[model samples]
Target: MNAVLRVAALGLGQLVAIGLLLFVSAGTVDYWQAWLFLAVFAVTAWLPSIYLQITNPVVLQRRMKSGPVAEGRTVQKIVMLGLYGSLVAICVVGGLDHRFGWSAVPAALCVIGSALAGAGLVVTVLVAIQNTYASTTVRVEAGQHVVSTGLYGLVRHPMYTGNVLILVGLPLAVGSFWALAFVMPGIAVLATRIHDEEKLLGDELDGYREYTQKVRSRLIPYMW
Candidate 1:
């Protein structure tokens, strides 16, 4: 599909998915937090998507890919499934929290969460702009090279850095403090995925090993 059409499809899919998920989980449409959360999530996600479509439609198309990486490793595939599953769980739990008043997340926290998600989206777009080979699946693309500039200079996995930030912000945005616990395991799984990515890059992409040495950090600066 074309880039514009792809973006439109994805955006529509998100609205439908979020609307259904929230309705199913919360059992009502009266939850203001869910509405706010969806708005923030949709706007942030689509803004970057549109930017990528304009600047690098090829990368956006690659990001839309659905399949295994080069190795087609089953374990990694399971981890990917688990990650997606956890994302769904997050919304469900958040809806339950809102329905039952499980946790009284303050308005301030929700605002902060929205800001963090926005920041994460910005970082993600920046990573995509810098690294043309940053596909959704973990693999070394044809003619792909290590991107040591911009955010990569600080963290080896800057795209994942954005993901980490989003994970932290999501629970609060959805009005579920307890859902934060769910984000941690996903982060750990992503760490393993990053390990697999780097291993592949070091073997297949020249200079990646050297870049890793220089950066030292994978998803966080001056740490990890």
Candidate 2:
């Protein structure tokens, strides 16, 4: 398949997954504006990477064809996907609750939730800008070298940090205790992914261990 088509297919598949969760949780409830924003997030996150990968297939191919750094613990991937699915489900349910006037969220909580969600999104943007060249897949490019600068100068995995921010913020956007509860699982998945990623990097990437020693943390500043 053409790379664009292949990526578009993946994008559609993601949409289907999210859509199923929305259907199951909302039971025919539709909130156009909120859904539109959700779609916006999807496009913003996925589209640029899709275009980059399509335009730079050789870079992607090199990464994929490269030897495994280690046996990746795909359990983290599954758990993360599940958390993302649950975010969609909770958002759908929250929308339904609001539509039917079943929402119990106080106005103060709404403000707090929106603030958290916005902060999370802002963090994601910062990380993306910091590591603009990192691959979407687990592959090393021909010219790709370990990045130990920018955000990497502080933490070994700013992208994972951003992921945690976004995932935690997602529940806040939904504005419910049930949605907020999902953040714990999201954090667990992030922790697992970070561990797995570090294992691979330490084993495969040159100087990564030294880099880690210098940084000393995955997310926090001066403290893990």
Top candidate, metric TM-score: 1
Cα lDDT listed for each candidate:
0.79, 0.58
The residue-by-residue lDDT of candidate 1 on 147-179, one tens digit each, is: 888998889988889988888887888889988
Q: Estimate each model's TM-score.
A: 0.92, 0.68
Residues 1-224, candidate 2: write the lDDT tens digits: 58767766766786566555554566653644345435655655456546546666544433222112322446545655665655655676665665565656665665555455555544554455555445433433354467778878877777666666666655445445556666677677667667776787788777778887788988767777
Cα-based RMSD of the predictions, in order? 2.0, 5.0
Clash pairs detected, candidate 2: 63-139
Candidate 2 Cα RMSD (Å): 5.0
lDDT of 2 at 114: 49
lDDT of 1: 0.79
lDDT of 2 at 152: 83
Q: Candidate 1: misplaced stretches above 4 Å?
A: 1-3, 66-71
Judged by whole-model lDDT over C-alpha atoms, candidate 2 comes out at 0.58
TM-score between candidate 1 and the true structure: 0.92
